[model samples]
Target: MTRSLHSTDRLPASARAGHWNAVIAEAYFPLDLTFRDAARFEGQLEHSNVGDISLSRLCTEAVQYERHRHHISSATEEQYLITIPRKSPVDFRQLGREVRCDPGGFILERGDEPYRFSYANANDLCVLKIAKPVLATKLRNPDRYCALVFNGREGIGSLFTTMAQQIQRHASSDPNSDAVLSRHLVELLALALDRTSEVEQGAGSSVRDAHRRRAENVILRDLSNPDLSPEIIADAVGISKRYLHELFAEVNCTVSQFVREERLKAARDLLQMPNPGQMSDIAYRFGFSDQAQFSRLFKAKFGQTPSGYRAQITAACND
Candidate 1:
């Protein structure tokens, strides 16, 4: 569905501020909107939903939006916003980090967290709001990417931004196609985040970060090898076995647990596909020793057995 709201619509200038507040709250979530000049402040919001994800283009005067603790307390599910500024820069503070993203760059904001987002000048912005689970299926720890600016001018970032704009401009009327586009958008975003070097900054040290990334790459490459253990991963990355364990520990995850989770995520992705092949073959393909173990682990991670998850996807598609 597609709809738009503008502050100028039939309301007196004196009432625009209060009306604007409601307009924005309906577009996104409830927030405190402080307009530089409330009576004269102007804004326009165009919004559409493609599948479960929402795309909105906001054009507004200088304003600040604050998501307070009370707002978060009322949220049903965690969400993330990827904002791309077009005319001016935006200042965002969340999760103890503050950042200013200019045109040609984008920043992420965690919706379930208290945050302050503002721009000093009028700005045209494209924002994508997606539920946490939708993105988590493609990227691990989506929260860590918040408050970081990503290049929207090149490579995967370029593709993602371009596609978002296109989708907002020509949102499909067909729900099935919209669902496919939504998945593609998420996949592109996952690739963009995966390829970014800034993601490793969480490790706290350059050398350790590089080592951790290298180790993760090796693990991803050898995920199909049932014997792919920490020792093998460490040896391949030219790091000591003990050091490899230490690196993973810093992230509060053990090497084995990380491997298992990645495998489960991979299996889940396959299950979502139209033709995921046989259950036993899918299990063994991801290095699971047997179907029973795969089912147990998949259920533990995703709260559903592999077959059940597949059936759920199939049912949704049929509907």
Candidate 2:
């Protein structure tokens, strides 16, 4: 279902307080609100559901909101609320930390905890609610994925920003595709959380180590090209092909093997898209020259043929 709300009119002078109270109760907090000059309050909430995820786009003219909390009826279910601000700014507090979110900034809050969010004048926000168990099953450590901020301008954050925009566009164009898009969006979120956790735990390698970082970056950049031979990549990076082999050897894999694995991962991502074509087309697009060769390699890596994997994703999306 798709829902949108936009309003520009004021409520009756006598009923202004009640009108604002009702709107807040229905959309955000189910708690009491005390306000001054309620005659100035005006807002709208645009929301939509895509499978298990609920998205709400909100905007407010002027209002002072109080701190509030809500309890979930299901004891076993955990909830995560993520807010992405699109316009103006919002001040948020969670887990003993305070954050100011502007456009392209996001904040995560746990449902079981009480928090305060204050939005200033003329603010636009997008809120996404996700179930904890759903994310726990995908992440390495679920408890660590709280109160994180993602700046949508660099690294994995940039990738996630692109994915979110794509999903939103697709949801608007083909509502029926929501189920699949939502699932992928969750996975993307999970991956982002995991990457962030790694950075926080000091698990990521030091980028200041120029040699290792540059070599890794070069391999990643050319991993999709069918002609991504180690010799060619080494030449492009001004390194000997033998050195390239030695670098990957430290990771217990050959350069060629890594390239193949990367290509297969790329192919899998493409197959998951809602494309109207044969599986062979997906294989070819990912640098596979021969369909049968691609099938053999993909099946070996994933234990399923391209067609079989596509069918499974389609069925899951429909369900």
Each candidate: what lDDT?
0.85, 0.65
lDDT of 2 at 33: 55
**Cα-based lDDT at residue 17, candidate 2:** 70
Residue by residue across 1-319, what tens digits does model 1's lDDT show?
4556455566788899888888787878889989889878888888898987999999988999999867876788888899989999999986456778999988878787678999999999999999999999999877667777889999999999999988988867898998999999999988887776754445224556677889899988888999899879977876556557877987899999999999999889888887889999998999999999999999999999998899999999999
Please list the residue runs of candidate 1 whose C-alpha ends up more than 4 Å from where it truly belongs after superposition: 199-319
Worst 10 residues of 2 by lDDT: 200-209
lDDT of 2 by residue, 31-132 (tens): 345444566666666666677777776677645554433333223555777777777777766434556777776766766544567765677777777787
* TM-scores of the candidates in the order shown: 0.64, 0.53
**TM-score computed on alpha carbons, candidate 1:** 0.64
- Positional deviation of residue 89's Cα in model 1 after best superposition, in angstroms: 0.6
